[model samples]
Target chain A: MRRMSWFNATSLTLGFVFLYLPMLILVIFSFNASKLVTIWAGFSTKWYGELMRNEAFLDAAWVTAKVAVASSTLATVLGTMAALVLVRAGRFPGRTLFSGMIYAPLVMPEVITGLSLLLLFIGIGLDRGVLTIVLAHTTFSMCYVSVVVSSRLVTFDDSLEEAALDLGCSRLEAFLLVTLPIIAPAVISGWLLAFTLSLDDLVIASFTAGPSATTLPIKVFSAVRLGVSPEINALSTIMITIVAVGVITASLVSKRAAVKRRNEEQAAGRA
Target chain B: MRKFALIALPYTWLVLLFFVPFLIVLKISLSDLALARPPYAPQLDLSAGWQGIKDFFGGLDFENFIWLTTDDLYWKAYLSSLKIAVISTLLTLMVGYPMAYGMAKAPEEWRPAMMMLVILPFSTSFLIRVYSWMGILSTEGYLNQFLLGLGLISEPLMILNTPVAVYIGIVYTYLPFMILPIYAALDKLDGSLLEAAEDLGCSRFTAFWLVTFPLSRSGMIAGCFLVFIPALGEFVIPSLLGGSETLMIGKVLYEEFFNNRDWPVASAVAVVLLLILIIPIVLFQRNQQKEREAGQ
Candidate 1:
């Protein structure tokens, strides 16, 4: 059963290569000496230097960062509240509608979501800018956050909160002391998920952002639309590397936590 | 009281932001296009009272929807989008199945690392992932150079800015979605069932067909939906990777709103897109409902 058959091994290798080879190529070519992106003559660090000095890219990155941080924080709070309602509320009016609204945005097309949101902002005469981007990002990403946090909530031990209640605590106090600390990991992951989502968004940001405010993705899209340049390749490489490191580090940390918990539980049982 | 506050806050936010905006799109889809700043006509002016309400309803028409049917550009875009989505979803399934099967079939201790490897690319920005293909698929790109160097072809292939490139981009980016669900389904499958099938005089291939493949059906369906739904309304792939010859409803919708400044017609296009999506969305919901009920 543990035998590694050639059939499975070949497919896995080829499949991963197919999935990753393009990005690998893009990363390798980022250091190319040529102005034209595809043709590589020799190694150079000029594009990275150029990327640093490009004010437009820097400004866009700043806006994107601000939007991601603010929106993800707001989304985390709203989404945690939404998750509490979903997991704990019973037989409330509009329960079905509430759940429906939470799940619908996860599958809604970006174009549709963006367009609908834009019209809403315009209909009420809200100027499109950073504020609008934050609003739009918060609305959609909050759904993702709720989905993340709620999955953890469904498996949560209610007896701990009950124990807190039995100790003469109020409902809110019980929740803060018992429920939140237990679910903090999921909540933090939810925040990170929302953060990445906000950072990755281009279509929604484009619709909600005014001419005065541009995001990094919008800048990359417009630049790539003109044709691929070494600077963009350098930029893509940086983004990919950062995400790669972050994801790897996260998985390792979670893995170690799981292993430590299992070992401690075993030791406690043996003792 | 606190529970009510908890429920009401998100509820009100969704109602105002999500639900109301959808109704607005539906209303604008019915209204006429204007040269005004907001662009659509038949604005529902509450200030004018019952008279304004009556005039608004009277002025609203299905003219833009009728316009959608009359123009063949929108029709071609719809059909092409459907075609591309169907093909790409199939391609993604073909590429992702073996990988997911491999992950599920791997030895126990290696699974976590393998799973992380699969998900790592997905954490990167989607636009960057799609843009990665441009450097490889361009005529003078690495792919052509490699093929020509290998003597695989006499001349470089023109893959970029074509439907083929769109298929690649979609399949590449959405492969993780396809793999994850199917892997879940396969990982849950009992290995003993396959062993018993083989013990009952079935060959290895026969046992897999009889016992394993059928069990993975739910995951396959879910994975297909995950890829197909987003691919249908994808704008970035077509606009960036596809040539001018390529047409998709999402790209058209974007052009209508931003390039042409025709809000009513864009809303009409969106309405039709949603109508098309409703079928799959309903099916997906029903499938999930069935799975949930079955799980219980």
Candidate 2:
């Protein structure tokens, strides 16, 4: 076995510390009794309690949840379709352009995407509100979902679908029963990812949001810009906790599924 | 029929929602600004049908683009954005390379957890993460306080409200993008190749230099572009962290659109930014195509 090099050890420790230090600091300071973010006077849950009492924060969070749910669901459906077309559909007309369009949004600057979509909304005389935000988020987030689903699709065994067809199931039926079930995990993960993205996005939402459709990120951004109070830190800590719990739960579920699959395969081999 | 339905649904949605918007932006970019409800001249009248379309095109001009060229602020913003993006990309790579390498070298069982750890911060609210940096890097923040306590500094270092803070904020935010791709590249590397080099009397460092670094070039490039492209258009980090000195094009575009209400000018800026981004966009597409072909 290769020994752990000093360089590797130092890099791992330092890298993790660098990545987590700001977040840890934010979390610890969220409970500080002082209004000032820098000084740690004493620990208290007042800020968290105050955050709970903030009506604007509560409203933004509700808007964020609505947008995340709507957009992620929309993105998953559309993205799954796009992924299927890319992976399973034979070369169709405008295949190259279609692929480009699918992937272009992945790296397109948020400002540009936001700006362009805003312009589109204005040009089409559509109202800029939660609907526009959902549309924008869905459009961009679906591209990411398509990428994830497409990678999984590329590795999928087409023979299974072919066999299902041979066994008298129609293509749609087979896909619904077999392919969809198998790719459900990827689709779910994609939805989760899209949800997180929609939730985290401030720039896009800022451009597309109407007077009454403020998202949590936009709200947080405005408050943070004004000043970094413990209230914002308290909000951040809560947001971090939610994300951490979600990710950890997702990871554990996937891990357990993998182990179960392995055990089933082992039993089948023994039989 | 099923296939047609599947294809038509998303394809139509993207075309209407994603592709056509760029055309609208292009159209707006060519129009002159006006003090109207929508704030641009030559508004397309769909009610007039074909004649309205012709009239719209007829009224469009390159006035906004011309105005963009005359302004030094736009040029400076573009230049500063490029400079900062390049520097930040390099910094992210330098920091991320080691972290990625270390993660890839970690035991197999720990790899997933390590990756999850790297990605956990990324999943958290991006605005919050940037806000967290302010608490650490401000003059009276944690960094200054710690350094003072350790007697490492005489005065509170002017870290915040500078480009240094921007760099730090960027590196912190984009670090995962840099790390994930490089770790993937390193993880896929065969151990036997390194062992073969070791048996041939090469040291670990030399072997890594010759074998690992060269192999990881694509991942590095991928990571760099991921960081660089977004960093170029980054508005939040510079505004909140870099103070007034940071003149990224994204901020400029934001100001022109919202502050000045120059929708035409903002559209022009977005058009030019897209044009500037075309090179990397093409490069990235080519890389993806090559990867797909390689997979095949």
Candidate 3:
């Protein structure tokens, strides 16, 4: 038993190291004083300073932020509506096709999707640019949001909506007043998922984006082709920290809600 | 009746935008290469008429398909891509499985923290993660510098701009993808079964092999397919780390489409790539259905 426990601990520690050692090294070397990329002469904040002042990176960052926000918002709305429809409506003639179409982008290679969309846009004479990027991003991102929202919706009790309708509320009013509030958490999570996906996208963005429509991923990819710099490291570290904080906060809040619900049920049972 | 339209709206949008585009690609892939003109026109020539129809039906050429199969370059690219993808998927599994198993067995409080660590990397730009590798693995990069500083080597190891670099890039980029699904699977694994095996006087190794391994196979398979399929078709990492020497199908397709201006050949390659990807996807779907049926 002691031997087994030791083995388990060793395996776990090794896993943690494998997952994080590269990232830890990345964060450490971001502050490396040398510009040669390999030599760690000492620590410095010069890279972060350089990143702040880099005009092209700054512009790309701005573009990425806008695209993430806009596409995520669009995806959330469309996806939430789609999820509500899929979950609430009875089995229809095209239900399988609808579900398959929604999830198809999830598995399709990004290159194929990007190329096909690029072809479509060109065929229609719509120049590739920010609009096309957003459109492409939204197309895939909506699938993710729909999957998340639909899974959440599956656990939802239909009686809540039925109860509201019974209490003289119209279907729309019942959805807004009851169903919407219940699924708000799923919607928020779906939105965040969409935002992260849009921010992280590269391949699809590469195909759809024009010269003036570079995102942060595109900017970094182009820059690395020339040669890597510590400035890129600095940018990555900041982005990782922000995402880590968001995920941690969201998980904690959700866990607490679960705990609260369990406690409430226990109390009601005792009463 | 009104709600029907509301539901129909989103489905219609997806069919028109998403499904139609794929159908367009399929149509283009089937059309003659000669008919491909600027502004994206796929013309059907009836001059050859019945012979062309017979050729199409009989699979006389499949011109593009035949080109892809007969060409040495295409076959080499496909083989290289398969080799890289398989090796990387195995490496990811070897590294990721132990970690996911460990996380699954950890204290509940620590599980969330550990899972966060895995997922946190994904939130950042994937291109940056790949770029970060360039800094670490390059001859003048930190790894060589650190090793050289320690007198571990007389000369910097030539690691970058090779197939090894491509492997490193794919593993690093897709590690989280492998971890998340496996972690989820392991987390949901019933501990009582392991306890039962131990109670039955089974050794720890036997217990895990008998109980945990089988249970986690789905996640393992899912993770492997996820990593392997993308790695096979990946263009970016190969383009970046592969330098000039590496021949990857994704890069080949990219050149065909963008550089060579051979849209028909590009379409052919895409079709073949899609066919390759579909095999794993079908197997995955079958496994999922079996699991669902067993659950019911």
Candidate 4:
């Protein structure tokens, strides 16, 4: 209702700059020919070439991709189930416990989660490996997906499912055909979110991963700990570009779908 | 039968993976450190039946918890972690509130893009985001270099590896968490209500203070908890950006577990950290439950 105040404008400008300037600096330095990150050197793709030649980093990236794919898929299925139970099941037994377990991971610190999960694996005699890492990721990322999907489920129109059931569809078919299609966007976004989270996670993975299975973040973290180098910068820049592109595309698709859905709804209203 | 399946599968998974782990951590915290394979004493062998159970119970003690209290470093780390978390949450709220307000007030068409800008950084790797700060906060980093270039300072300020850098890292990383929730609340606010306040002879600023601020209180609390809880146990920011003098519970727990190879102490630290976090977390859960009820 009100125009953008000068205060709000200044705040937004400053806030965005604070958020993006470090990333901008990191990207710019990734192209530097000099070994040092801060120094200005002639433009070069040497670091990117070097990253390509580094086997460990490549291996780490491969491991990360596998973990992301496997974990996110499992998280999505489990999370979708959790969201449905939370939204549609009403006050089932242990409802509070179910909700608590679902939401706890969202705010639980990585150190605690990592430590606790590691202990669980150790206690259960499960070997620390790629499988353990996937399990850990799935546990935490499932919570995130539940949060995303549950929000969508809350706003969802249940009448459509009711309508489907009234039209002689079975309960299962009503959900599969009507509810699932409508909430597919939220589910998809939830999967992508879990994928990114699993990919990006370093702490939990570090704790659970065996000696043979280092993820990319762990690799970069140890290398960066040795000090800033242009090669790591190059690797980081690549990772940033991939993630940024993925997020932007997902948002654009979702936004377009939302607009189209609204238009159809308006047309139906008129008819 | 189908409803039972839907609830049973995920519920069993969480109980096995999520809930069981915490129980294990608690059990481990009570165990004595040993030079054994699992690095703890009196292991619980369920296959051995009653004898193994008795051995496990016999070995359990409060020695690690006692040791935690005896160590000044552990207590100091916990205090400093809480201090940093509280201050950073406040800072994020201050920075995020105006930005969220702006986004909520912006043209409807631009809102999605604005929301995307906020979510993009979040979807990126957390470690890289912190790493980017290292390049900007180091003594020879970008910020100091820029200031030096502009003649604003005679020397490169030692911003990196300092507590201030940790603050910056926390605020930068958690700003989106603060903003998004607040924006959600503000966006849902009735424009007519603000107009009503103004029509009753209130200034626009007072209208916001009285009407908008109170309505957005839930979001602010939610945002603060979201930022504060994880930040308290944050390991990366403190380890990478903070100076040696900087102490946080997460770093200390890490050192105890890995460097010192002391699982019992680390578990004890974790238990304490969780105990401290319980209050805010329960409050957050209550708020979420209330919101869910309101929505339904």
* TM-score on alpha carbons, each prediction: 0.98, 0.96, 0.91, 0.94
Better of 2 and 4 by DockQ: 2
Cα lDDT, model 1, residue A116: 98
Which residues of candidate 1, in runs, are more than 4 Å off?
Answer: A263-271
Over B223-259, each residue of candidate 3 has an lDDT whose tens digit, in order, gives: 9988887888998999888887888888898888888
Give the winner by TM-score: 3 or 4: 4
Q: In lDDT terms, which candidate is top?
A: 1
lDDT (0 to 1) per candidate: 0.92, 0.91, 0.82, 0.90
Task: Write one digit per residue (lDDT tens) for candidate 4, span B1-296.
Answer: 89999999999999989998988899889998999889998787889899989988998999999998898999999989999999999999999999999999888888888888898898788998999998888888888889999999998898888889899999999899999999999998999999899999999889999999999998899999989988999999998889688999999998888899999999999999999999999898799788779767
True-structure RMSD for candidate 3? 3.6
Model 3 lDDT tens row, A235-268: 9889878877888888889889889889998999
The residue ranges of model 3 lying beyond 4 angstroms of the native Cα positions read A1-4, A260-271, B32-61, B150-152, B188-192, B199-201
Q: Point out where model 4 deviates above 4 Å.
A: A1-3, A155-159, A162-172, B45-51, B192-207, B289-296
Report the error of model 1 at residue A58, Å: 0.4
RMSD of each: 1.3, 1.7, 3.6, 2.2
DockQ of 1: 0.82
Q: Can you tell me the CAPRI class of model 2?
A: high
The top-ranked prediction according to DockQ is 1
- Clash pairs, model 4 backbone: B161-B243
